[model samples]
Target: MEKQRNVLQVNGLNVAVKSAQGMLPLVQNLQFELKPGKILGLVGESGSGKTITSMALLQLLNQKTMNVEGSIQLHGRELNGLKEKEMRGIRGKDIGFIMQNPMNAFTPVYTIGNQFVETIRIHTKLSKKQAIDLAIASLEKMNLQEPSKIMKMYPFQLSGGMLQRVMIAISMCLRPSVVIADEPTTALDVTTQLQVLRELDRLRTECGTAILLISHDLGVISELADEVAVMQKGRIVEKADVYRLFDHPQHDYTKKLLQARPVLSVNEELSKLVI
Candidate 1:
């Protein structure tokens, strides 16, 4: 089979924050590729630099306080040194972002419809009516009910899962080439998490959008990612195809992580085994 085209590439990526002591490296020499219609799962424990790496790729870090070095290419275009104005054009249009907290992503004061319309108009030449129509259509795609009514509600008025689904809809509305999802299923019930994951999987199939899924859960990675990269202490310790990584992890850290997964049966049958 022919190799798929790469939508995003990161090489020698590093992030360092200025501190009283000196520059502290948060992410070191990170590298990865996201291909069209493929998901790259970045998995690691908290403070392992996964989120920082994603932010660096998006050029969302503050340049003054945080020093980010290396190449971040989207469709072969360099994103490292682009001005804020130039980056703005690429953000929602070329690459969409689903933040960890859906509430943090929206303005509590604005109605969902109003925010969607503004986002759509900013990226495209759509009029208010056109944008509203598009927004409602996108919501429908997520299996959301009463799209028109939901649009009229403020972000605060909606449930967490509802807000998250709406956020996913907004991220995908423009059909961006890449979507950076940062712990998208965090703080959700298992059923809701599955729903969100399904929506993400659908985006990959329907829009052929590459995904950079950041999470600490190996199960989530195994479910959605084609390839996986394991990060620890600011560096990638292991990377491989999903099956290979799970079946035969090369690094000690990876092996430990796999072993750490809670075995429901083992715990439940512990008393029987002891007797």
Candidate 2:
């Protein structure tokens, strides 16, 4: 057996926003790679440039207001500075993105079926009817009940967890090589979060999809990520295997983050809350 090649690679990546002084860097000299069927968790606090890094990879940054420098390669294909039209074709078809807010993933006015079918048709040659069937099957895989009925509904008609699963269903339907899940379970309850995480795990195991999991939650990172990258002040301070990073964090910031995880009281004793 041979080791799988990296599905996504970032080297010397930097993102900057125009300011009065000059181009202010948000992410600097970032470097990492995500292999097929592996999850690389990017953990950081707010304003640490985690989200910006994701956006830069997807070529979603506003070119007029922001500048993304360095290499962002997907399966050896360079993505940096691609035209919007070219990027559009790659966004959902090659690299799937699961946003923090499920509501942001869909439009409120369109029927779910309509949006799903259109998206599928755009990337594939399937007829509308065939696309709908594929969509329903994808939803069923996520354990969404009454998939047919749900298709007729609007985005606002569903719960947050349902919508999140729906987004996952859509992403999986395309079988993207890489999936960038940015705080995907943030709005869901504990049980729902578990479901989402499990689904992500299934995606990797079953379909060999590489994932970039970005979250501020150490617990989430610990549970789902094979490797972890700790970000602070717009730079990756440390990168290590999940277990090693947790047990023997080298960076001071990494240690601080581990210490910051919430603790629970057990028989009048404080115990670190386990994921």
Q: Compared with the true structure, what per-residue lDDT tens digits does model 1 show for residues 134-239?
A: 9999999988999999999999998889999999999999999999999999999899999999999999999999999999988899999999999999999999
Report the CA-based lDDT of candidate 2 relative to the real structure.
0.94
TM-score of each: 0.96, 0.96
lDDT agreement with native, every candidate: 0.94, 0.94
What CA root-mean-square deviation does each model show from the true structure?
Answer: 2.2, 3.0
After the best TM-score superposition of candidate 1, give how far the Cα of residue 221 lies from its true spot, in angstroms: 0.9
Report the Cα lDDT for residue 262, model 2. 93
> What's the lDDT for candidate 1?
0.94
Q: For candidate 2, write residues 85-117 as lDDT tens digits.
A: 999999889999999999999988899998889
